[model samples]
Target: MKLLIYDHDGQLVELEDVSAKTLMLGIRDAGLNLTAQCGGCASCGTCHVYVDNAWQAKLKPPSELEDAMLDVVEERRESSRLSCQIELTKDLDGLTVTLAPGSAFE
Candidate 1:
């Protein structure tokens, strides 16, 4: 699967994933600044990302828990999502997401 990530500065980086990890794990593995502190549990909201508008409708809506987590993020927007909630699959190949500011790296 191919994942395209836009960092805070808008630099685009392409990543490939053979392991079916969630988007959060893929970002962390790519050595980006995303700490993803809660792993894929969707609790800490550290994996916040903005799905590219063109790809937004392709993703499943956030779960109730994920929605709640997103609500508290200061940078939340219509495109904001918890990357941990999105498992990468063939369907998600070529997905693009931007690192949102609320992602708590520390």
Candidate 2:
């Protein structure tokens, strides 16, 4: 349930045991403006984020559809992943991610 947030400002914040929330929901609940324009259905690339290398191996890889959608995101990178696709878990306690610039709901 721990969330390691890489904010728009390039800062890392660790949130502890935040519940079984999706990454996008947790970000919003934490007062961050991560966008989930398609309502967490994995439709849009608005919630695009870059998973830290250290945690990448621990996460489930994005589906083919997700990888396709990520191509449309601005500043897409090798580590890019949609926040909505990331489910919170105890093993992800120290998971780190970076918010893509201009991907916030605002």
Model 1, span 1-106: residue lDDT tens? 8899998778999886546578888888888889688778988888899999999888999999999999888778999999989988778889999999867475
**What TM-score fits each model?**
0.92, 0.90
- The sequence of per-residue lDDT tens digits that candidate 2 reaches over residues 33-52 is 68778878789889888898
Worst ten in a row by lDDT for model 2: 13-22
Model 1 sits at a Cα RMSD from the real structure of 1.4
Off by over 4 Å in 1: 104-106
lDDT values, one for every candidate: 0.86, 0.83
Worst 10 residues of 1 by lDDT: 16-25
**Which pairs in model 2 have colliding backbones?**
none
Top candidate by lDDT: 1
Among these predictions, the greatest TM-score belongs to 1
Deviation in Å, model 1, residue 92 alpha carbon: 0.9
Model 1, position 43: C-alpha lDDT score: 83
